[model samples]
Target: MISALAHGYGEEAINIFNNMVRSSMKPYRITLVVVLNACSHSGLVQEGVRYFESMTRDHGIVRNQEHYACLIDLMGRAGCFDRLIKQLEKMPCELDGRLWNAILGVCRIHGNIELGRKAAEQLMELEPQSSAAYVLLSSIYAALVFKKKKKKKYICCSWKVGMGREGETTYGGDWRDR
Candidate 1:
């Protein structure tokens, strides 16, 4: 199922999952995560939400951080910010770096600076040494700047790309220093 999803065969993955369910094979937690992920990648928002709710209700599978992260990723990819916020508010567990990274990733795709900033902040707080949050947030900033200025502008650290000579460190470097 995951292989199908990785190959962009989201619908095929879901079909395989349904076949397993129909064959009376009880899905484990990871199985449901893959199913939800397939739905997210396939743009099956409603189906993903249904599956998330039904995880415990219908399948007796308790929803975990992975499940919520999948749901967040789904909503984020779909640009359903309001719905995603509501879902986040109702999350049973504390939001972790993985979940925040997923949110940051979606924000980058959607160019949502406000939510992206929030996610990036949470991620940086959770994993300060990790560069993923910085990189993604910079992408979001660059996208917004491009949209507004109608041109390419590097928005990394505190410097723009191509503005410095080789070995001079055109980038602003790491955020941990500041």
Candidate 2:
């Protein structure tokens, strides 16, 4: 299920989840995790929200921090900053680095430096040792700088003929500092 979702087979993942439900396979927190992730990736924001909002009501699954994090990622990717802000404020669980980092990631995507700084501050306060927020902040700045300087961002693309990709590829590859 997770493999299908991770590989962008969102419909397949949904079908699996439905089959699980029909078969009475008790879904744990992890099941919804992948479901929400698939929805987020597939731009099924409304569906994801339905599942999240109905977790406890329908499946008897209580939303934990991770669940909230997935919702945040979903809204962030969808560029619903206004709704995302309201959801963040109303989040039942305590704010954590993961949540803040997710916000920072979306801010980076939306070119929202102000919100990105705020997320960075919050994440730094929560997990000072973690470098994820710092790296994301750096990326935000680099993007802003690139726009200001109008630098031709040379996307590094390696091509071994008959290997894989044919055109210039970009490296959004390095998500982890490690």
TM-score of each: 0.81, 0.84
Show where candidate 2 strays beyond 4 Å: 152-178
lDDT per residue for candidate 1 within 74-153, as digits (tens), equals 99999999999999998999999889999999999999999999999999999999999999999998777667766654
Q: For this target, which candidate reaches the highest TM-score against the unseen true structure?
A: 2
Query: Candidate 2, 91: how far from true, in Å?
Result: 1.1
Tell me the lDDT of model 1 at 94: 93
* Candidate 2: RMSD to truth: 5.2
C-alpha positional error of residue 123 in candidate 2 after TM-score superposition, expressed in Å: 0.9
